[model samples]
Target: MKRILLLLSLLTIAGVSAAQEFSGNIALESLIFSEPGLDASQMDDNITLSFKPKWTGEWNDGDDAWSVEIFLRADNRDEGREHADIRELLWLHLDGDNEWRVGINTMFWGVTESQHLVDVINQVDQVEGIDGEDKLGQPMIHLKQYHDWGVLDFLVLPGFRERTFQAAQGRLRFPIVVDTSAPIYDSSDEDNHVDYAFRFSQTYGDLDLGVSLFKGTNRDPQFDLGPGIPHYVQMTQVALDLLLIADDWIWKLEIIHRDTDPSAYQALTGGFEYTFYGVYDSDINIGSLAEYSYDSRDEGQRGVFDRDLFVGARLAFNDAQSSELLAGIIYDTEKHSQSFRLEGNRRFGDSWKGTIEMQVFSNVDPSDPLAAFEKDDFLLLEIARFF
Candidate 1:
């Protein structure tokens, strides 16, 4: 709370002395499940309201800038789903080809469409969803240098934010409640443990490559199921991400090697997306996606991407509304389990937008990792108005 207040104070000070830009949105969301209830503790109704606000200020003729973003949600069904977070609060300094950022910020680094296995800088806001796209703000000092060879990013993270989880009343949760508060760290400092990372990315012709090394607590924690309770086990990870573009074909790959107590393994997810441009000479564009994921671990995989195949499509309607649709299915090859997702969004008028998302799970074995969500298929609808 004190850090949040300090960040707001800085934003106020910056706004008073420089030109400021403010924009954000508020939204109403509803989630409905196909089954009556997944468990005894499941909520009957799923509805929520969210508010997102952003403020940005510029000074020194654009050489320096500061920004803040806050995300808040009020869920009527589950207290765990109702949350507030500082998504970003950072000041940036730019000098020629070098840049520096300080304060809390969010970073995303990966090229795979099905799973972002290489993105480890920020903790996952798990309550947001299982997509692994939403991330919590990470407090850090970051530097970036650009040169002919590539771009180098160095980060010094002073604190670690543990991943969030769903409460008992929340939907789409595991059968056993996760004890998020009890996280065991390899480092004694726990959340205050200072961590560091570096990444080098370059583009050579049609090929783009990135390699990163993180020597700190892992963002994704392994849960220890002892006596029917859960606890986080921290570890370290090294990752690589790459992308290749050839005309209408785009290939993406992400690989990671992790080291944790009692376990060490490597994982990879790679695929290609082919676009059929101007389909039938129409303005619409259609794209097909295929990806495969592999984990060295046989049965204790934390995610659903172990030994799975992902197939999907992207649809873009070049219309006034900027309509788009993305549909995908992740099939567990070994267990014969499958998870499907369909997401669509479009703008409504100048200041409003709407989104609809549907998720389904099928053929999940009782012993599979996704067994908890076997009956948790849900559809989500959201509409937002911009400032």
Candidate 2:
């Protein structure tokens, strides 16, 4: 709360002194479960109201700028889902080929569609979604240098954010409630541990490549079976991501090798998407996607995506509403389990937008990580008003 007040105060001061821009959105979301949850305490339906506000100011003829974005959500059923975050509160300075940024910020790094294997900068906001796409902001000092050969980035991260989990009464949650109050850590500094990362990215012809190195506390935590508390470990990781653009085809790959206290493992996700422009002589474009994921770990220790295949389709309607849809299914090769997902969105006039999302799980094996969610299939509908 204090941080939010400080951010608002800064924005108010900036608005009085510099050129500023403000924008935001309010969204209402409804989620319905296909079946009753395994736990009797879980609810079959849930509603959430969310607000996101952003403010930006520029001075010195755009050479120096600062921006703040805040996200807040209120959930009817789960207190864990009701949260607030400073998605971005940063100052950026640019001078020729050098750039510097400091504050809380969100960073994304990956190329594949099925999963993001090389993105480890921020902690996952698990209560937001199960897809692992939502992330919490990280406090960091970022430096970038642009050169003819490539771009180099260095990050000094000071604080760590623990991943959020659903409450015991929340739907789409694990069988055992996660006790996040007393998380264990490998480092005595715990959440105060400092982390560092460096990345170099370059484009050669049709291929764009990035390689990164990180030494820090692992973003993904393992569960202590006895207490059901999350345990963070210190580790070093090397990651690579690449994209190749070929006419109507796009190929993507993300690979990572992480070393921890007692073990080391490598994982990779690779995929390709082929697009058909103006299908059937219409304004609609269709894309076909296929991806494979692998992990070098035991079956029980691996993630749901380990040794899995994902096939999906993307549709784009070149209309005034800018409608788009994506549907995909991930099949576990060894376990014979499947997860189906569908997402679509369309703008209603200039100020309103509507979205639909669905997820279904079938034949989940007990050994798979998603076994707990086998009966948690759900459909979500959301509407947002933008200013």
Candidate 3:
């Protein structure tokens, strides 16, 4: 609460001194489960109300600027989902060919749609969603340089944000709840550990390539049994991502090699998407996607996508309403488990939008990591009003 107040105060002061822009949205979300939870404490339905506001101010003839975005949520069923975060609060200075950013920010660095194997800068906001796409902001100093050959990015992260988890009463959770209060760390510095990352990206002909190196505490944590306490470890990672664009086809690939305390592993995800314009002589576009994932880690230490295949389709109605739908399924070859997801959204007028999503699990093996979610199929509906 204090941090929010301070940020608001700062924004207010900046707004009074310079020309500022303000925008935001308020959303209401509802989730309904298809089956009962494993525990009696979990609810079959949940509701959440969220607000996100953004403010930006430019000074010194647009050479320097400040941006602030805040997110707050209130959940009716799960206390763990009722939280707040500073999505972005940073000051940016732009020179002729260089850029500098300091403060809390979010960075993304992957091209694969099924999984983001190389995006390790920010911690995952687990309570926000199960897809692992949401992230918590990190405090860092980022420097970027534009050269003739490529673009160079260097980041010095000073503080780490721990991953969030659901409460015991929350649905879509593990059989044994994770105790977020007592986390163990391999480094004695714990959350104060400093991290560094460097990336070089360039485009050649029809292909874009990015290579990155990171040395720091791992964002993903392993769990200790009996109490389900998270254990963070120090590690180093080298990653590469590529994207190639052809007439109507797009190819994406992401690979990573991670070196940890006791073991090392390599993982990769590669996919292709092909789009057909004016489908059926209508103003609709359809796209087909296929992706494969592989991991060299042992079964116990691997994630659900270790040896999986993903196939999906995307539909876009090029209308004034901006309607779109995406549906996909991930099939685990080793465990024979399957996960299906569908998401669709449409704009309702100019200021309102509606979205619907569904998640289903099928043929989940008992030994698989997704076994806990076998009975947790859910449907979500959301409505948002933008200002």
Residues 349-387 of candidate 2: C-alpha lDDT, one tens digit per residue: 999999999999999998888889988999999999998
User: What are the per-residue Cα lDDT tens digits for candidate 3 across 193-268?
Assistant: 9999999999999999999999999999888544678888999999999999999999999999999856999999
Please identify model 2 stretches exceeding 4 Å from their true place. 1-19
Screening candidate 2 with a backbone cut-off below 3 angstroms (N, C-alpha, C), the clashing residue pairs are none
On residues 8-97, what C-alpha lDDT tens digit does candidate 1 reach at each position? 567556654553787889999989988856678897558899888788887999999988888877776777777778888899999999
TM-score winner between candidates 1 and 2: 2
lDDT on C-alpha atoms for all candidate structures: 0.86, 0.90, 0.90
lDDT of 3 at 27: 98
Model 2 residue 166 distance off true place after TM-score fit, in angstroms? 0.7
- Candidate 1, residue 272: lDDT: 99
Residue 233: error of model 3 in Å?
A: 0.4
For candidate 3, the lDDT comes to 0.90
